[model samples]
Target: MARKLPELKRRKPSIAEQQRFILICEGEKTEIAYFKALKAQYRSAQISIEYVAPAGVPITIMDKVKARMAELRREQRSNPSVKADTVWAVFDRDEHHKVTEAIAGRQVSGAQVAYSNPCFEVWLVLHHEDYHASDDHHQVQKRYQKLDRAYDPDGSKTPDCGFLMNRVEEAENRGERQCKSREDEGMPFGRPSTTVYNLTRAIRAAAEASRPKRS
Candidate 1:
């Protein structure tokens, strides 16, 4: 006889849903997974969260995010009840950071958006902020030596920060690799959501606490 499979069950929503919105990120799969995890945890809460991009695209991230914020602000201005929520622009501090100023100048054109009154905000996550693999000096040295011949043919030592940021790319690549490996093995993979997860939850909790006391 074949083994019986576990029974499937459906979970019901428990909390009243509120509305909240945030700018999504522009990066690889790792970035989206983080957002999805946080969304899952807060989905039942009295909050409605919307994202700017479900598919990661670096070129349009900043522009699209700013556009979304402007749209939200415009709507909020007309409708007092509607409010601008937080925008988290998460990016990797890989080689991209070196060219970000130029990219920001040409690609992203506009003033940054701030959140609504009472409690409004923005968040930024640099590649190295959460976790980094190249912090392992041994690995960095190994990788640097391999790339030195082509990148620094003259053999002069490269700046540590620049080299480290390059290694940050390696870290990100490794993360992508790990994610792929999990998928290949038929398993789910994701980042630890302690930081973004807690931040969003705290925002919701604080908002709830500060809401006008009900009669």
Candidate 2:
């Protein structure tokens, strides 16, 4: 008598869980466009980036972020599947008051802040070179324009994502080094600096973590 052999079934590979980040931006067009470009460049099944543009000063922006965080909390309570792993308020110190207050509020709420001195354009400039000179919003715009001729000072143009994508790591490195230098010089909250690198670092980490492991 011959024994019948059983067929083996293969198990499906497991996918990494997705992480969601909610970014509350101060600029309606430029900031939104930049973050959207970043999201597209890092497209991954396990990472989600959402943007909210309230278009206001630092204090007002924080207010909107707090409200949104509350709404997210309520949704999460109703459905555990709905989650926001990180909440970030993106703003620049462009003649706006209450910058310190906004930073303090984020600390209390356990949220993050991607703050740039003069304007967000400073972060873009770091992609090309290390900029230590103090600049106002207008000056930083010119600096960015010089580095990226396609950059528009007005909010009409979208950033060149493809161009910026290749230089992101360089920008992060320059930004971190500048910040560290400032901190060491007893000017922890000095101008000509940005914390936008922190946000981008988190995004990269989340995307990397979501990638499947190979045996």
Candidate 3:
């Protein structure tokens, strides 16, 4: 018999890289808080959400995002392998002149915008029922209260991201319908429209997809 058999080398399994996301929002409270809750809900180590400082206006928010991104690039000089899959700026058009500028400005840094015309509340209201009005910030809240009885009219109460997330699909479909209607009316990305659902869906899907499959 052959004395010594050659030892076989075992192959190492491939480990997929984590999906990286950098989210910058105009609102310090709602957008930031909502995204934070969303990230926690997934509880996936394969997904990363970078935090940027709170900004008030759309242009200012874009400024902060670009600054942070510049910092990241400098960091890459040392790390040499750091990369971000997506960098998104979430903002609303609430009579702010800079909103349009900010959305168009994303081309400079290659960042994407999850824009909601009129206000972010449009996206939030969609979670409850169908809304196609180009309502201002206040009206959006009123509509949201109809769905969420616990909603507080005063500034004291915070957003209900958990409740909204539970019906994310419904909200997403409604938002799509609104956008489609706007587009058909020659007003794409105009009032009564929101692209927040696009960002949410991508985050949820990518977070789940990056995880290793279990037998």
Candidate 4:
């Protein structure tokens, strides 16, 4: 018999095949730090996370996110398998009128927006206790002060700040209740609502799903 053909080498799957979460945020550091913390806490190794910030105001953030994702997809044509599995935008409803437009407008390339009414600090405050008052971001900061006097608005979180990561589940429950209440009522945009919790839940689910089986 002729010599056996040389064994063919199999190409292993590259890291590019892994699932990814693309995030565009309004803040440069706080949201980025928070997500980085969540990624670590959840040990989401299977899912790659890309966060883009300093992305301008709400509407601008949306535009940048869509444009960047489009560029990525165009470059990824060589390997369609390498692409963002999920895309999301995180922004606060502070004085930004464009926030509503960003929310109501059509999602770009199926990217979802996670907007916190008043401000994202509201979601952070919910970690300690439930709040439904229709106040602005400063008021939300006050609530946070009750839990941690050293809270900083410019994205400074000390070691104790890490505690918020532990109470994520509690925060999600509280936030969902508020979100449902807002939906039931006829409240408009920036009226004490937040979808940050939902985004967190989605990330958590993706992380769990990406985990390898024990067997």
Top TM-score hit: 2
Error of 2 at 147 (Å): 0.9
Error of 2 at 128 (Å): 0.9
Error of 2 at 25 (Å): 0.6
lDDT of 1 at 95: 26
Q: What is the TM-score of each candidate against the true structure?
A: 0.40, 0.88, 0.84, 0.81
Which residue pairs of candidate 4 clash? none
Candidate 2 vs candidate 4, TM-score winner: 2
The number of the candidate with the highest lDDT is: 2
Per-model C-alpha lDDT, please? 0.39, 0.81, 0.76, 0.72
Q: Model 2 — TM-score against the truth?
A: 0.88
Q: Model 2 segments beyond 4 Å from truth?
A: 1-12, 45-54, 81-84
Which prediction has more favorable lDDT, 1 or 4?
Answer: 4
**Residue-pair clashes per candidate:** 5, 0, 0, 0
Question: Candidate order by lDDT, highest to lowest?
Answer: 2, 3, 4, 1
Model 3 segments more than 4 A misplaced:
1-15, 45-55
Report the lDDT tens digits of candidate 1 across residue range 30-83: 334444544454443333333445533334556666676677778889987764
* RMSD after Cα superposition, model 3: 3.8
By summed lDDT, the worst window of 10 consecutive residues in model 1 runs over 115-124
Q: How far is candidate 2 from the true structure (C-alpha RMSD, Å)?
A: 2.6
